[model samples]
Target: MNRTLEIELIDELIALKSARGLFLEEDIGHAPVERYASDDQFDTELELVFRRRPHLAAHVSELAKPGDFLRVDLAGRPVLVTRGKDGVARAFLNVCRHRGAQLVGENAGCQNRFTCPYHAWTYASSGELISAPHFASGFPDADKTQFGLTAMPTYEALGFVWVVPSPDSSLGAPFDFKNYFAPIAAEVSELDLADHVQVANDRISVAANWKIIVEGGIEAYHFKIAHRDTIAPFFEDNLSSFRSLGAHMRSIIPRVSLARLGDSPRDGWRLRDHANTLYSLFPTAQFLVQQDHVVLIVANPLAADHTELRIATLVPKSEAGDSELWMRNHAITRTTLDEDFALGESIQRGLTSGANAKLTFGRFEGALTAFNQSVADTIAAVS
Candidate 1:
């Protein structure tokens, strides 16, 4: 983060401390229960919202060498992302051109070529078809070039790989990361995310809608109640601030220790020293920024009542040593997330019980409203 922005967010924190207040909206917000329990709504989200958004497929470090590859599910599409011998990252539909067989069964590995189990059709890491089992005898008139894997829109920057899973024409044609992020580009650049290496990886499945889990991350209102024995004591009482980044969000949740800074002459102050900054990379992911490391989380909604999160702990190269420390941190992070997600699951069940028509968001928890509004707006725009 820029020092100026750090100072600004801190000063806001200091003010909230003095006033014993939190960020508030002009009015409370209500979201219909249907948003979570309705099958049609979930289908629309998968088709409209997820398919059209950029997914953080993998951190570049995961593909440290040329020809490294990983298979990921983006939206509902099976995607194969590869770091080619030419040192460029690319994405393709993880389907065999010959028979639509699901190719690349492994989750991740270092391979320069892939062979279909069904027909033995081979493809290079660059997604070019290399050969067929019997080119001379079978379909000799077919063009091998036309049988190559279908390319998805792919962009690599700031040490991360981004791919739009859909074939939307607007995201194609060179597929640049839209300039929508231009405003916060400098702020994100200062984090030097590329300088980090992932130290841990885990997946957790929760019986809750994906948005419910996302909403939990952007608010501190439930910290004391939901994470009482875990992360609650360390943070303030419902105290945090947030700002919109295009359709995304950035939240600053301050710690109790921040109060100790106490009007002291400040110089070279850092936000991470006293708070956790959370970034919602809209539609699918969040980057929980801590002083020593970052936690990359991607939520994949499996159904109206189920979601799976892929969590990776990233540590700066300077702190990548001390594997035990990162392991402990990852464990603690998982514990806290489990606490939040347990409650999320409970909320989903409540929504199905027909107790309330809509859920309420207090004026202070404005980010939830903004997020839901963004979803509604996106789906509405094309409706």
Candidate 2:
């Protein structure tokens, strides 16, 4: 850890020890207050958090290579990320330089060239404007060089692709992901996420602000009440939540011992006695790291009251070959996510009733408070 973070961590540790299950007044009251979801000012905040952040997107090892490509929505714009013939990753606005049509509609695939659906405008993996439907006709002034797809700024590190929508955006700004995550990158790096591959993925839309849904995953305070049937039996009421870079939070739930049950043995199942780790990366990414696998939830907010949550289950390359574990984990993952989203959507409907203006964060919920505070700071700074 850096000296600055070390000092902050020391203070946090001291506070944690002294308060046990409460937050300091300064940590809560001193925090800035603002609406992140319904407000128009930070409309793109979720997008920046998901796609532009270096540490968050640094989960891919390579981008450009023979037949390598990925498609992602950068905020509302369609983005096509491709590895060129020269083995360099490049990102282009998915719109064809001709007539503003989407170049690639599929989620992801390896393609040597992209062909527009409306016209036959095609582009190479390098995003070079290659061929147009008809030439030497009505439009002789068209320049292929100038018509190449709008390329976005991209960089690859730690195995993921990071993109900046504004090509000329400042790289040294405070919100620059690398700077924002400098303090906690080591902690995140310890997970060795780059070593894992996506085993399964599923998505669902919920009626809730992105942050409201994120709040569901960041604190264990609700596990006892909301997930009593599923997660409560496995965790202790006393949970530890840590605030890290970019207003991200990690929740640690010490596991319970089930071996005491009549016929249960502690042999192979002893691993369950370890802690359950939950990580919520800004602005709305949730990751749960278990002994065997890592589950990532990329929450994309579409409206003030609607969010799309994508769940990706990742496993070690070796374990990915196991069909039985994949099947079992997939089912468990789906059921758990549905349970969370069901509640989150319900809360969204409730929050709009004017019955609740501000929600209080219990001492155990300090991480959520810290995350909201960070959002407030970012919005204020941007303004």
Candidate 3:
């Protein structure tokens, strides 16, 4: 290899090591109430952080394109999002202009227009009120232009969509969440996520606080106990070494397993020793990178104690068809994910019982704590 190339390789290795090495147990477990499931402050804080933080809002903004649409219920408000013809993704309240019925009910699909079912009111994809059942005479004062769907504040970035449900929200100033993610963003970019396409997505409902599901993804402390048979065999149980960002954290697990994975592989699909990277993006999203695939789970809180987890598996684009490998991979991921959801739901049940007023986050899990604190600060500021 050239001398310059060798030097660059050495630098990259050192940087990777440094990124994975600098975490403290004290940091993971700090500020217990911040992440406590029963803490009302947790919900309040999260609402503020998500609604007010412009930088955080930018992550989903960058992913927008013309006609791109997604539906979201952020902080208890239903949002219908779309990238208009001009190539800007915008979010609007999904309610119909007449009698307030929801216009779009399906999860997501491309459309040139949205038609209201109640009275057959129709609107363009850009949210313009173009037609109605009785266009000539519903009411003389009813102007089509005045009845456009309500627009919400929106921005797309970082391969995700984000929305604020309030029409009066002051989130217009451009803030890039990718920048706030900083050095970690650069490190993650090494995975070349753009080349990967979603191969499988499993949506699940969990009877737990959304944050609890997030905690389950971030910390390795529970692996030896909660996931002994399932995950422990594939990951290092020791929590001494993990990496942290102020509001994000990732754990790297080597692929070596006790199952003789290296030698016993004669088969169709086998679990191999590989680097597994897990990332918890602040309050809700969890990104898990296995050797052959990337699993992303975003938890959306439906109620104080109910949450929905959206799981998407991204595989190399070449493996697009419905092949045996795809099915096998999806099955394995589904099983592991179900197990995690079970744990999260049961934990939420325990938390709601008032048996424990606080929950302790391990030092390696402090990124969870930091995120909770960030939520607290945001809610406080908004309040």
Candidate 4:
């Protein structure tokens, strides 16, 4: 973050601590419960949001060398992302030109060529159809160029690879990656995220609406009640603040020990020392910046009440040897999130039960309100 914003956040934290209160919105916000339970709404979101947005595929570190590749499933399409010999990262449909068989099934690997097990149709790491067994008599006039994998527009920024599922007609225009990320680009750039090595990457299926999972991360109003046995003791009760970064949001939840910073000189007060900053990266990802490491939580919506949640732990390259410490950190975070996801599941069941017509967001849950508003506004504008 910039110096000015850092100081301002520090001031806000100190004042909120003194007042024993949290940042609040002007009024309560309401969202219909049907939005989470309707199959039609979920299908629309999958078509309008997931298929058109620039979804994060993998970090550059995951594809550090040429010929390195990773397979990711996005919006029901298996995407193959590879760093070619030319040192450019590219994405393509992970399917063969013939017979529609999946070309590569491994989660990740390093290889110069991929040969389809079904037909022996081979392709280079650069996505070129180099060879096909027995094409002489069966199909002598086959064009190698025309039989290559379907390509998807891929870009590397902030040390991550992002792919748009239908790039040509996404949002009815060319997706402007730079402009879309302008709000939080400089802040993320300052973190040198590319330099960090991913320590762990895992996924879990959650029985809850995607929005419920996302909403769980952007506010601290429920921490004291929802996480009483796990993380509640460490954090202050309902004490947090947030700011909207374009359509995305950034939130800060201070540790209960922040009051001790009052004894230290203001010059020595570091933001990370007293709080954790969580960045909600628009539609699919959340980045939690802690003192020693960063955690990325990605939500992939599978249905109106199902989501695949992927969590990744990233740490500085220098700390790669400290497996014990990183493991402990990862375990704690995972446990806390498991608690949150459980709550989301219960909430989803309630929504499905049709007991409530709408859900209410209080003043303290301003971050949730902002996030819901952003989603609504974006979908409305696109529709």
Candidate 5:
């Protein structure tokens, strides 16, 4: 972060600490329960929001080598992202061109050429068709160029690879990845995220709407009550602050120890030392920056009521070999997040029960309100 913004955030933290209060909205916000329970609404979101936007697919470290690759399912489409010999990261539809067989069954690996299992057709890491068996006699006039894997728009920045899920979408004309993320680009760059290596990556299927899972990360209103036995002891009671960055948001939840900074000089204050900064990256990614490590939570919507939560714990490269420390941090973070997901599941069940027509977000839950509104506005504009 720049010095100006750094000082500004510190001032906000000190003010909140002095007032012993949390950030508040002008009034309460209400969202229809149908947003979370209706299948039609879910389908619309998948088409207009998730598919059309650029999603953070993998960290650069995951594909550090020239031939490294990672396979992921984005908005129900199988995607294979690879680092080619030229050291460029690219994405393609993970399906064989011959018989439409799913290619690259493993989650990740290093390979220069991938051969189809059924037809034995092969492709280069750059997504070019390399060879096909019996080409001399069968379809001799066929154009191999047309048979290559379908490519998706991919951009690598800040040590991360982002891909547009739709194969037909252009990365330049309609959507510019750098411009779309300009608001928080500096903040993310300052963290040196590219220098951190992922120490642990885990996925959990949650029985809840994806939005519910995302909303749980942007507010601290439930820190004390919902996390009473887990993380509540370390944080202040509902003390947090949030700022909107385009459609995205950045929130800070201060630790109880932040009170000690009240007596310290402003020149010596460090925000990360006393608070956890969480960045909600528009559609689905939540990045939590802690004192020693960073946690990225991505909510992959499988259905209206099912979500796959991919959690990656990234630690500084210097500490990558500290297995014991990283494991301890990962375990604690996972347990805390598991509690939030459980509550989200419970909330989903209640929404399905038809007990209420709408859900209300209180003044202190301004982050949640803003997030839902962003989603609604984006979908509305596109639909």
Candidate 6:
């Protein structure tokens, strides 16, 4: 967020701390239990929500130099993003044109050319076909120019790579980065992610719906109780703030130390020192902003009740020498998120028992309703 707006929010948090109040919505809201337990709904989300929108594939820092490349699965389609010799970022289908074999199997690496393991078809980082092993008399009539990797719509903005994932015209065609990311673009720019690099990371599978995992970050109603052993002591009990950013949501969870800032000068106060800021980046990603590093959490839904969670801690390149601090940040995030996701697993297991017709969101937990509603709206817009 911009410094002016961040300072404004910090001031609000300070005042709320003094009054012992909570930032809430106009009224309470609720979501249905089936939203997290139904097969049909899960399929609809994969098709309508994930496929039809741009996905946060990787940070620009991940592909910072020429020949840098990374492979990712967005909505089940394997994609390869590369920083070519021209210093431009491009994305492809990650499939060799000669055969259906994957172009890159490793998650990330730096290579100017990729060779197909099946047919030895070589391709440049620019997606151009360089050579084939059996071009002499094997396929005399073949046009090698037609066998380059298929390109997808890709944009590099806000220090991240955004891809449509699908080359089809059915959805996400004519990708519009400006409008799609407009709501939070300025805020993200203020974060200067381009100047940061990933220092620590973890990946795990959680037995819960992706939505269940996301809802955990947007509310603090469970922080004190669910995280009593980890982060609860540092944060105020049931006191947090949130606001909608188009399809995204931003929540600021103030620490207990913030109460000491009452009537103090804001010039010396840093938001990250007094609170943890979480950004719900639309579909299946989150940014956990902390004091000296940012933790990115991306969820890949394997099923209605299973998700692959990847966490990466990014610190400013200037501070990359502080390996201990970055590692500590990653560990704390991993521990706290593990607690929240485990609770989500328990909720998912009980969601099918027909215990409640609808799960209610308290006034302070209103962002959950907003997020679910956005999911429903996106899915419904297709038909």
Best by lDDT: 5
Q: Give a tens-digit lDDT track for model 5, residues 154-267.
A: 889866898888775443354678888899888988888899989899989999999999888888889999999899999988878889899889998889888888788878
Prediction 2 TM-score vs. true: 0.80
Q: Each model's number of backbone clashes? A: 0, 6, 14, 0, 0, 0
Q: Is candidate 4 or candidate 5 better by lDDT?
A: 5
What is the number of residue pairs that collide in model 2? 6
Better of 3 and 5 by TM-score: 5
Global lDDT scores for all candidate models: 0.87, 0.64, 0.62, 0.87, 0.88, 0.86
**Which 10-residue window of candidate 1 scores lowest in summed lDDT?**
167-176
In model 5, the Cα lDDT at residue 149 comes to 88
Q: Point out the higher-scoring one by TM-score: 3 or 4.
A: 4
What is residue 50's positional error in candidate 4, in angstroms?
Answer: 0.8
Candidate 6 lands at a TM-score of 0.93
Query: Residue-wise lDDT of candidate 2 within 1-383, one digit each (tens)?
Result: 34465334334433443455433334432221235335563465644443444323224633434657777765656778888887777777888776787788886677788888997888999888888867548469877787777776676543456666443234344235466555556766766677777777677778777777777776666666777777677765545446555566665554544223224532333322355567666665667877688888886667777777778887877778987888788777777767888887787676646766656666567777777776766555554
Which residue pairs does candidate 4 place in steric collision? none
User: In candidate 1, what are the lDDT values of residues 340-363, reduced to their tens digit?
Assistant: 898899999899688999999999
lDDT for model 4: 0.87
What's the TM for model 5?
0.96
- Writing each residue's lDDT as its tens digit, candidate 4 over 1-383 gives 98779878878977888987779889998889978889998988888777777788999898999999999988768899999999999888898998899999999999989999998999998889999988777788877798888778788898799887663523456678898888998888777789998888889999999999999988888999999989899898888999999988889989987777888877887888789999888889888999888999988888999999899899988887898889888999999999999999999989957678999999989888899888888788677
lDDT of 6: 0.86
Q: Candidate 6, residues 1-383: lDDT per residue as tens digits?
A: 66788788888987777777888788999888888989898888888888777788889888989999999888888999999999989889999988689989999999999999998999999999999987868879999888889887788987788887777444444767789778977877877988898898678999999999999888889988999999899989888888888888888999988878765887877788899888887888788888877889998887899998889998899999978877877888888889999899999989988788878999989888889888987788755
The positional error of residue 319 in candidate 3, measured at the CA in angstroms, is 3.1
Work out the TM-score per prediction. Answer: 0.95, 0.80, 0.76, 0.94, 0.96, 0.93
* Candidate numbers sorted by lDDT from highest down: 5, 1, 4, 6, 2, 3
